[model samples]
Target: MTMMDALGLIENRSYLSSIVAADTALKAANVTLIDLEIIRGGYVTVKLIGDVGAVKAAVEAAKDAAESFGALISAHVIPRMHEETAKLIEKQKGRPAASPEGAKPTAKQEKEETGEQAKTEAVQEESPSPAATERNEENGQEKLTREQLEKLTVVKLRQLVRERKAMESATQINTAKKAELIHSLLEKMEKKE
Candidate 1:
């Protein structure tokens, strides 16, 4: 019978804890680090692959290490992962290890290094420039009507807020819905008036 490779996973609420777990797992067995997914809202998942015995050992060690940090969410080992499951995992593999010196650049990196910058610039030029807000600034305050503010995209609205010196609320601006962004912009405009 052909032996199948195994997959192990460890999840933690803290990135630091997840890193520690991954390190411990690597040290504990002959497993390979597959990826480290940084989920939204601060959760992180460490993925490892190897023989069943090695993967199980690695996951156990990782779980113990992560639990010591009081941030361990869960840990699991699949003795023989299905091909479809492996494909799904492959699709989510975003955290490839850093390349050693003298390694060739990836296709994506090469494209970015060549034509991506010019393409991005062309697209930006074609869009309505938000530079109008900067030109309308009066005494460090932006003058934008509700209609004008509503017409602007969320990205432009965030930029306007930052230019108006609302640094403390930058995080809120990033996660806010479009309606919230519009409301906040109006409120900031009123405060300046």
Candidate 2:
């Protein structure tokens, strides 16, 4: 397998802009599309892997194309990624090994299995858990609120606060107060969406 010497990334606020970036990147060079991850708040990040030269060229083309559609959030190229980074990327893509050793199934078979697992996991996560419903039930856990922010942990709350920069005043408050501020901010964000 050829080692990918570089990884290019282009993030855009709009999904359509991200698609345009991905198309431009693929057409501009002999690179592999790593993934198009949908981040919070309708943002998307397009990733590509290839030789350094190819990745650089593809990223430039993608940036230009993506900017035409909407605000280009960010763009960068990793000239040489760490092994852990490669492993993480593979995990995210759920790609089977390039070579199936021993009695292992072929790459196509592995991919099909992985794809099915991903779909199943996605469906389960997207649906509200039974515990999160039936508010009258004396389950210790609170029901899932309409904002859905209550289900998230404090760490996730901080991450969202940084992402949206929606509540500047919340940063100075206590943890519980911070969470309240974040919830209100997130509600405003959803309304805008």
Largest lDDT belongs to which candidate? 1
The residue-by-residue lDDT of candidate 2 on 1-193, one tens digit each, is 2344688999999999999899999999999897999999999999999999999999999999988986699999988777667656776776643432366776777778998999898767755577665442443333345446655556556655665564565544235454675565456555544
Q: Give the lowest summed-lDDT range of ten residues in model 1.
A: 91-100
Q: State candidate 1's TM-score.
A: 0.49
Off by over 4 Å in 1: 1-3, 94-193
| Stretches of model 2 off by over 4 angstroms after superposition | 1-3, 96-193
What lDDT tens digits, residue by residue, belong to model 1 across residues 1-193? Answer: 0127798999999999999999999999999998899999999999999999999999999999999999999999988877666656765763222334588978865765568679877656534455655433457555667777777677887887677654357678788887777777677777766
Q: Global lDDT of each model?
A: 0.79, 0.74
| TM-score quality measure for candidate 2 | 0.49
